[model samples]
Target: MPASQYADMFCVEVWPENAPAWNLFEALQTQWRAGSGGVIGLDYGVLAEELRVREIPPADHEQLRADVRVMEAAALQEIYAETEK
Candidate 1:
């Protein structure tokens, strides 16, 4: 689930500091939820614009982006089924 995967797919982040944590992303077909193990959710495009207008720091915002990218890449690779091996 690299941000690149979700890059073309639709997605949205979740509440900060929650149990499900950064594990939730609303996409076109399904929700690629995050587990306790990885990634942070960051808003995108116009959504990010709103956050910026509200004075949210880009550093804080992109921090989540960087995380989502890492987690998503791992998740995508994880889609490899045992049968495929």
Candidate 2:
């Protein structure tokens, strides 16, 4: 896909332990959809529902989480550096 396809993309990671965070997520989703006239692309519900039916093998779960953590950290660091510039 072209890079522009993801220009407005946003990602969130929520573990079972942080289930309450979904309330905030839902609120953001509502606000974004409303402000953008429902043109913000795919909603989190799409991914959430996909995750509901998909099962990750126990062996790979930790590694997947760790990889996501690393990527998220890097992205945040990049953003911080950019802001400091």
Best by lDDT: 1
* Whole-model lDDT per candidate: 0.48, 0.45
Compared with the true structure, what per-residue lDDT tens digits does model 2 show for residues 1-85? 6676675475656787544334333433332222333232324454344334455455644544444345445645665577679
Off by over 4 Å in 2: 1-52
Q: Write down the RMSD of all candidates, one decimal each.
A: 11.5, 11.3
lDDT of 2: 0.45
Clashes of 2: 0
Supply the global lDDT for candidate 1.
0.48
> For every model shown, what is its TM-score relative to the native structure?
0.36, 0.40
TM-score computed on alpha carbons, candidate 1 = 0.36
lDDT tens digits by residue: candidate 1, 3-77? 889886956555566312143222211334446754323334544444455575666666655554565666566
Extract clashing residue pairs from model 1.
Answer: 1-72, 1-76, 2-72, 2-73, 23-34
